[model samples]
Target: MDSKNYIDSGILELYVYGALSEKESMEVSQALQQHPEIRAEVEAIERSLTQLSTAAAPYQPDQVYQQIKTKLNFKDQEVAMIPITRKRTNWPAYIGWAASVALLIGLFIQFDKNKELRQEVVQSQIEKNLLEGKIQVAEEDLTKTKTILSVLRNKDVIEVPLQAQQVAPEAYAAVYWDKESQTAYIDVAGLPTPPPGKVYQVWSLKLDPLTPTSLGTLDSFNEEATKVFALNNANESEAFGITLEPEGGSESPTMEQLYTLGVVNS
Candidate 1:
């Protein structure tokens, strides 16, 4: 393209504005080198833009810009207009960047430590809840024990010993009968745990015709931690016997499965 025509096309303005692609900029640079007039036009455009930019900026004292540089901790820039003995390193820039890196590292460490502390606090709360649950269970067990002891020590309680019978010679039990209240507490600590779907039934026996009356069943033999069970017994009893039967008590005592027999003292 001819120099006058290229200048008139406004491509030089685009070039000055850095709006051209790399290849296009190279082409323009080459054209400017070959045509002195194109180079002069580009320079004129740059000078006018620079003057306009200076005029658009609000007036400020030289000290205002210098104070801004001081706050930024900017060091003395290289003076190309004056000769220097040696190339000066920008120490302020290096120190500022190092301080920023150190500050970031410290913040990261603090954040990690806080996260770890939060996890530890959560773990502690879990352990505290578990300990409190255990303490509650223990307190309940102690309360039951105190109640059993108080029942045994009553003046109205009648103590009776049950001897092991033919079925289980090793088994022995005691009956604490509160005659006033018609409540009999059977201590079956020596009795073995009954099989699944089976339970022990107690009988209040009469001596003459050898009649037996059901006094309910000992249902929770396995889980009775103190091995003591309370049953309602209001019969004019002569003897007490325990026999293993089905889940619910049998219609009459099963003599074959008799584990213990005790005759009440007269």
Candidate 2:
């Protein structure tokens, strides 16, 4: 572009405002270098803006250049005008700042410690609840065991010993009968574990006629720790016998599978 037209386009104003693109700025700089009149005009614009900015400042310094010279020891050295930042040396002011910093650090540490303590308390409460649940289950088990023991030790109950039969000569059991209540507790603690997929069934026998009546099947024979089972015996049982059967007890006793037998006295 021609010089007069380029200067009139208002791009030189942008260059003075520092808003020109890098290429445009370089072009303007070259133009200023090539033309003394253009360079002088740019310098005049810069000086005018600088004066306007200085006049817009809130207040002029009171003591002016002399006071600035005295602070920098500039009379002998001809030092460049530069601001001197003041330093603080008051003991109380330094102590107050240090104390404030220490307090802030202490407060931050306390906050972290409190957060950790709250988390631990929550964890402790969860563990305590779990332990309490376990304790409740254990107490329930104890109550059930106690109830069974009380029934077995009743005064009116009749005790019957069962000796091992030919099939299982080492196995033994005992039955406590409450005739009036029609309940009998079979104690199979001495009996051996039944084979897998097998169970022991109790038979109420009428010895006079040699007839057998089915009582309930004794399941969980191996899993039961105390090996005690309860059954309702309403029939007049003259003899009690235990026989190993399939998963469920047979309608009639499997005589070959008999494990233990006991006869009640007349």
Candidate 3:
């Protein structure tokens, strides 16, 4: 495993706590030698645990001795020393063992809390990113809506409604032509969704000579929520037509696949 995955696996904590079996401990030791990062992590864990244990265990030898003497009912007066071998409570040993247990419990609790905190931070970041992405998308949509509204309200813009052709009787679309800016905003909301591997290509037509100029393909048709697209049109277009073409469009209009057509009002 990589160093990061190895460190995150919690085995290093167990190794430091001496809770791992002999074989596992040997393996960890090998890793510690091979990986500097693992060694550093182990050292850091050891330092933290040592600090916690030390802070929790305050050593007051004199106080402990006095307390022990008080508990034993001992007096300062000198008396004959006699060795009595009887079962007695080992208070010092018991206190040391209890302190060790408490230290271990405290370390375990701290480890668990730290893990929870890390998880919370990661989850919070994910949520934050998702919210930001949504906000960005909303902002872009708002900008597009504002631009479209402005175009529609312009007095100089020419509106042409492209009626459904025989190929697709139910499919219709409209074009807002701004001659000043040479921009054509086509609203394809009334048109049916294009099938897979096919796209809707727009054309600027001159009906007098039946000449067709390719504006562009609606490549982002499926992704566009408003079903509106803007394409550059510098040609003196007398008419507009939409045709279904293969992906990336074609060099010439496929007249048989024409979905909509409309002539500019004189």
Candidate 4:
């Protein structure tokens, strides 16, 4: 039966009043043993009935407990009786639980710290890779610049100093003309700024007839940090000159705006 069905059977009330037969009492005891809810209800009804019977008494028993104790021979007992067998320590269980909780908290904190350390390691690796890439690019640029420097230092190369001319007397430049390589490296370190919308153009000049050949314009003059440029010249050149011209440079040299002139050494 369900708990409510068992409760409504009135068997618990009969058991509480001690009015049930032996077989019925045994059945009720079995049901009470199986169902703790039914057992609790039976105990509640017994207690209520016991209280009612005690209240129904005309005179309360003062010596009744003493008489029952004498019948059981428990009067004037000297020896103390221990009720339970297990030796229990009050605080150890709480201390063990607290210690376990503390240990777990410590482990979790360590785990979080380890995770953070791992992230730091990964971030550090990325930073290292970025730095290495920058270093490699710098090394490559350094290698190229060093090769150019070595070629300019060769003994066979002729160095020419291009002096500032009348149009721009403050501007001066130098050229390292490698006749064999047909290459000229111009260092315009002392050159002044070109006028707005104009650029400095290089010219290869033959002195006998004063014939001039256009080499190329120094297009990136303002933006160059070193103020140096390289040009190819396979000419039987006698002199080098720089002139200021419009953006694309003139087909011929603009002698009026000439900035510098230098003669190649024999």
- What's the lDDT for all of these models? 0.79, 0.76, 0.85, 0.77
How many pairs of residues collide in each model?
A: 0, 0, 0, 0
**Candidate 1, after superposition: displacement of residue 151 in Å?**
3.2
Poorest stretch of ten by lDDT in candidate 1:
78-87
Reference-based lDDT, residue 205, model 3:
99
C-alpha RMSD values across all candidates: 15.6, 17.9, 20.4, 19.2
Better of 2 and 3 by TM-score: 3
Q: Return the clash pairs for model 2, or none.
A: none
What's each prediction's TM-score? 0.53, 0.54, 0.60, 0.51
Per-residue lDDT of candidate 1, residues 1-266 (tens digit): 68998887666765665545577778999999999999999999878755644445433334433453465455557223323223223333555567689989999999999999999999999999999999997897798788679878887677789999998989999888888889888889989999899999988899898999998898878877888888899998888999999998999988899999999988
* lDDT of candidate 2 over 1-266, digit per residue (tens): 47766665555645665545577778899999998767777788677655644444322233333444464345634433322332222333444567689989999999999999999999999999999998997886787699678877787778889999898888899988889989888999988878889888999999877999988898977766667787899988898999989987799999999888999875
Which residue pairs show collisions in model 4?
none
Give lDDT tens digits, candidate 3, residues 1-266: 59998987676765665445677778999999999999999999878756655555554444544553464455544111422222333334556788889999999999999999999999999999999999999999999999999999999999999999999999899999999999999999999989999999999999887999999999999899999999999999999999999999999999999999999997
Give the winner by lDDT: 3 or 4.
3
Candidate No. with top lDDT: 3
lDDT per residue for candidate 4 within 199-222, as digits (tens), equals: 999998999999999889999999
